[model samples]
Target chain A: MLQVFPDLKGRYGDFGGKYVPETLMGPLQELEEALDQAMADPAFLEEYHHVLKEYAGRPTSLSYADKLTGHLGGAKIYLKREDLNHTGAHKLNNAIGQALLAKRMGKEKIIAETGAGQHGVASATVAAKFGLQCIVFMGEEDIRRQELNVFRMKLLGAEVVSVSSGNGTLKDATNEAIRYWVANCEDHFYLIGSVVGPHPYPRMVRDFQRIIGDESKRQFLEVEKELPDRIFACVGGGSNAMGIFYPFLGDTSELIGVEAAGKGMDTPEHAATLSKGTPGVIHGSMTYLMQDENGQITEPYSISAGLDYPGIGPEHAHLFQTKQVRYEAITDKEALDALKLLTQMEGIIPAIESAHALAQAFKEAPQMSQNETILINLSGRGDKDMATLMEHFQEEV
Target chain B: MLTKTSFQGKLTKTEDLFIPFIVAGDPSPELTIQFALRLQEEGADVLELGVPYSDPLADGPTIQRAAQRALKSGMSLRKAIELVPKLREHGLEIPVVIFTYYNPVLQIGHEEFFQLLGENGVEGLLIPDLPFEESEEIRNRSEEKGIEFISLVAPNSDQRIKQIAEHAKGFLYCVSSLGVTGERKEMSAEALAFIEKVRQYSQVPVAVGFGISTNDHVQLVRNHADGVIIGSKIIRLIEAEIENIEKGRMDEALKHFTKEIRALVQ
Candidate 1:
């Protein structure tokens, strides 16, 4: 069988390349080689799966959302319960994989950048488990908003560094992380949190997280005796969406990625990268970026901190360009409404990030026939998003 | 007027080249031109003008701040490249290399960008983010335009330094340390050894850049490399003189800073 992506040059159809500084070139090459070797090694794969099974709770449930389906009153809906994973998010899948790779490479330290602090907490948790020193770069604003996750990261023995530059958000935090990685490439492994950044990272992260789609595909077939008609997931830097979508590529099932439309896309406040962004380079890879005409990156706004990024993963950009995946934007209000509805009906309070997917699914599910099924990747739990939810639903709370 | 020479030609004439970096359009573009001339007058052999970018992954806090200021002042890559013609028109004749990240150049089409640089009298280019592996297209097009595409080699480059040094044009940029561009208290001991390793591979002149700020840095790098490139400290100086430059006393502040470094390099 032919490989789907990441050609010899690490290009995902001219979108992904090693567009990093000279200091990181050798290290990235080393990592690419190591990843290739590790993937082919049966021992490495066995260890990775063993750890996932025993430590991170592999093969998370795929629950049929009967009430959500009834409420929509159109199509059957199923939730791939990545929220049940360790660290309460799908982020740990990639983090644990990378931490294992770091250990195999004899790297003793690992670093990561986080937006809502889910990835940070996940990285810290894996680091603590693997006995590697962890450092997480988070924006000052995010640290303020996700204080509980920050404290959780600290409690897991990871150092949290607050980035104050740019909009003091995810984009700046990523920049600082890359800067730190370039400087300290000799001793540290940058366990990037998303399916973004330079070449091998996007490929490697997707490979690690593709277990979600693989398991979902097997589970959905076992229950429905067929693939779901549609799959919905939110896109920040697109790790979770890519995870669930990669295995289903080329299949008859439709893939839809929902982006956060903050207040509204009309108000210039949103993180709808695929919907609104143009092809430009940011972080490291050439992808669809939220930048001005002069190529300066613009600050993205989303009530969901995890979705507040100005760029999407290059593979997602390629997928969007090729029309393999349908991209849509859901307003903050729509996501919140979906969040409340899901909580009331199913007691599944999702992270605001995943609520974007829920919101989109809620809209589309009602239009389909009852026999048609829609699978939504519930990417994370809502515990970290309680503060934002409480503020938005103060009257209800 | 300072003679317009290729970067390669300049290396033969000077024992030690002192290149000062300034972010174009910092505070304002007019001050940038003034500072460029001041550096030329203060014995800068080549000028590295940074085109402000929103995300400068290779830059530390000081250069990052300068880029932010420049970007806030409306400095786009087009505007920064347009400054090169302005420098030529004003009789500033040093070989000006526009130091930029690759995204801006990619945004402006590689052919059009190199065409603009050549047309604007730019002689060399330095993109810190475009490493040897990803630089083939841009580097080839730049050389075809008669513009030198500079390559950087880091201390941790290991055996890859040979491949980089062999294809390096104009001069090889030797990163003094592993980190982003910033002033260091002292140069790392591996810097000289790295430059020496680079010397074994290519005949091109080697200019050490990151963390080279003060006279002590200049003195240390001057003995091992053909050039010393100061970035963050000069940006820091320009930042300090922002108030003075705004009041039209730009020369007093800029001249003082450049002259001190110029005297040490000389």
Candidate 2:
């Protein structure tokens, strides 16, 4: 089912496709061809895996949350520790893989758009390592929010361009990046951060990130000798969620994706695109997106910069529509509370993006039997979110 | 529904074509028709009326600002298409093409959207994001409705130029630069070669756009292309006169606008 899904046109059901300017069609075709040849090459695959293990620190452990599970008092909880990766997120896996693809294609310059700055840092890290010129497009709002990551990216020799259009967020940054890529596509490679863009991108990024599920599935089977009852991961552009959910897709384990309900699903502020959104085209993919009656994309709000996107990945939209995965939304307050709970109980500071999934797991875990287990992808660390965290939890702290 | 001559037919009658693009309802709805008429009077063989969108990928800052003002004036794809008959009623005789992104069309769907273009006085439709490979459904529907769905070919479209030009309907759009819709100080040599390359395979007329601004830029492209499209520069001119247009001084503003337009094209 997974093999034949995207098909030739890159549609996951009625979702992803190459809806870009004519200037990009040639570049996109060139990229698709290069990626195909690179993926088929054993040497390329070996280098990607080798870098993941040696540099990015792959095989992130699946740790049993005994204390948190005891406090929740229902379902056993286990975390796939992606926060332990070198760049402190699952984003490096795709970044390293794509940067290697850029090198293989003989492209010297790479450009990317980042929301929470995780992908920016990862892309900058890989560029510095490979001696390639790196330019990362970030929203002015995000740069103000994630100051440390911005500094880290610059320290790693990446040029960060601040995009000030349309509420100054991930959507605007992506637009600027694509705009730049369209002009400079002859020499530069656009390293898309998530699984949301045009065809082959969603597929290629997912294949790079699928290692999360592959490792967790084997490790979980080793420890418990049985598959977990459910898997929970946060969905921004749904990259990390898709990563952890892809392997368990055909399994009996229930796969649930959590979206950022900034204020609430009833309000216009939430980023729960699949919940309240209609099917529309954004960033070249036809997916569930927050848009107006005239089909103009609306600004999405969320406490977590990573999950503030107005659209979900097309594959997630397909999985959502097909009922292959259940989607739930967590409010900013709920995620904050869950973040505090994990920090106090398990001594782990989870990224606010991942806390959306954690909060959902806590809700469902308490309703389930004690033998049932929940596996959540701790997608990133909370270090970059220090300023936002301090601002939100000032009184409590 | 209004039936009219195609933009390609205009190319046959006149050797040199100048298509001026302006965002519909830039400052106000009434002014849009007036501005379009002014361009029509200034030897504009075709007028491309842009449906103002919140996210316009191919547009530069100048045009993006125009779209912002247009959207603020309650302009939409539906509203822009509806504005075409009004332009005709106000005596806009030249061919009019609606330039829009793909999302609004996806929202309106193909069947009704094409029908709207036919019902209105629209002759051509150009969606920048819908390239040749993804334009199959749209191109087919436009053919059935007799609406020319214009094809766009860029400098990078080296080997793929043949495929895009094979079924080119009205005129093959030759992007004059590797960038988005904006003005440029100078056009590149590769762009000239690309225009010549597209001419080899194209059956219809060839129009060059995207940075075809300034007299030097226009003159250089004029030698290699059949038509030259100017977008951002015209928008920039109108934007500079937003105050006078709003003060009901349309005549005074348009006189100055015409002089500037003539300075570049003539």
Candidate 3:
């Protein structure tokens, strides 16, 4: 079989490198070699695959969005229901893999950073199942807005620390998590919650979550008997996109990554990194980031907590530069409209982050030909976003 | 006392001059310019004006806190460049080195940056992230424009030490340790041993950086290496002061911090 994971040193087209401090060098190397050995071990893969199937529920179905298709009027659409996963998103696939890896490595604690709190909740749940200590870093503002996920994490026995500095948001939380991990490198394993970070992580998360694409490819062929003409997913830290895009990447399918167009790309209140940001190295890898003259990270703003970040994952940066995928963004208002439309019409209350993919489908479907098949990853359920959406639409009602 | 070129020449002669780095917009880019002048006044042989990147991988909490303050002040690349001309207009003649990452340098094109810096009376450059292998174009262009491009070598790496020592013109920045820059009480014995090893190979003068915080650290390296690079520790001093004082009190507080570092060198 073809090799999926990169070597101990992460190199994805001149973008990924092990730009970590000296202390992390040993553990990362150990993790890399351990993971390499574990991948080949039938027992490890059997245990992981069994848990994903019996416990977490794998092979999530692909539902055709006929109502969304009729509304858009140009092409037929389908939804890859990753929302049907045990954690209501595709994050569990990778989180389960990493948690198992942590157990094998004898790591007693799990550390992660969350923006929308989905990854944190997933990590917290997996940590509880594995009986490992978990600590999650979240922005102070996110703690208030994503209260349900915060409480869920606490209930699952994970301690959630609120970061108050540097805009008090996702990027700042990530920075704080890195600082914490540096001090506790001997005992704690940083789960990194997304496809970004130093090395090994970007590759590891993608390989674990490739189940989304693998299932979608086989399911689509069985259902429609043809490949998708286009595939769409949102790009906040880009794990879900990597999940769905990996199997389709080699195929002749057009991949579209929608980012948050907060107010507008022209203003500072946007999180459309791939569309507006320049190529720069940050957080131990080179990637596209929203930066100022001295290369200080600027504050990113979006209605969706999940989509607000200064930089994209390094692999996505490589993909964007190589033109393998076309990157675009939808405004917060546009995403909210799609959320309401999907909930009211299709009876699917999609998560605000997933609604970003819905909004892109809304835009691109109209331009596509009648025969074009667009597959959108409905990544998470909207149960956690009800309060946020209600508050956003409060002025109207 | 000298022109920027001649000062750069002296820097190249010894191959090491104690170049003190402070974030350009940390306290405010306006005051940062004043701070640069003060460092010159206190005998900072070369001025390293750090561009205050938000995600400073190599720095500790002190510099990170200062960067947060600088970003809040609406600091931009244009404003940082504008300060170069602003300082030169005020007659601060030391070789002002723009110590920055490769992103901003690439954002504003290479030729355009050199032209802007040339117009602003800047004379040297030090980018810690840009290794010698990937810096040939920038190095060639910088040398052609009479701006001495500085390079860094890890303490015990024989190849990097020799490569940097041979081609290094302005100064050789010898990283004191293998980790990020921070404050610590005493220098490591291994670091001292590495510094001794580098001094043997380095034809140009070498300056020890990365956690050289105390006066004792400065004095210890003063014998083996030509100078000391103090960054995060000095920035930490000003960050600690900002919460207590009013806006007008910052200059006095910053001046006191500079005075303490200058006193260490004396």
Cα-based lDDT at residue B80, candidate 1:
93
Q: Show the lowest summed lDDT stretch of 10 residues, model 2 chain A.
A: A1-10
Q: How well is each residue in A1-397 modelled by candidate 3, as lDDT tens digits?
A: 4334344457667576655543354466667877888888999989888889998888788999888788889888999999989989888998999999999989999999999899999999999999999999999989988899999999999999998767778988887888788667678989977788777788888888888999999999998899999999999889999989988876888999999999987788999999998877666666788887556677788888888988888889888887889998999989999998888778888999999999988888999888989999999998888898888877865
TM-score of each: 0.95, 0.96, 0.81
* Model 3 per-residue lDDT at A102: 93
Candidate numbers sorted by TM-score from highest down: 2, 1, 3
Best by TM-score: 2
Two-way lDDT contest, 2 vs 3, winner: 2
List candidate 2 segments past 4 Å from native: A1-3, B1-14, B178-189, B246-248
Interface RMSD of every predicted model, in angstroms: 1.0, 0.9, 4.4
Native-contact fraction for each model?
0.74, 0.74, 0.18
lDDT tens digits by residue: candidate 2, A1-397: 4556688999998888888888888888999999999999999999999999999888899999999999999999999999999989999999999999999888999999998899999999999999999999999988888888899999999999999887788999999999999988878999998898998899999999999999999999999899999999999999999899898888989999999999998888899999989998899888999889887899999999999999989999999998999999999999999999999999999999999999999999999999998899999989877887888889987
Query: In DockQ, how does model 1 score against the reference complex?
Result: 0.74
Categorize the docking of model 3: incorrect
Candidate-wise lDDT, in order: 0.87, 0.89, 0.79
DockQ ranking, best first? 2, 1, 3
Pitting candidate 1 against candidate 2, the one with the higher DockQ is: 2
- lDDT string, candidate 1, A169-213, tens digits: 999999999999988888899999999999899999999999999
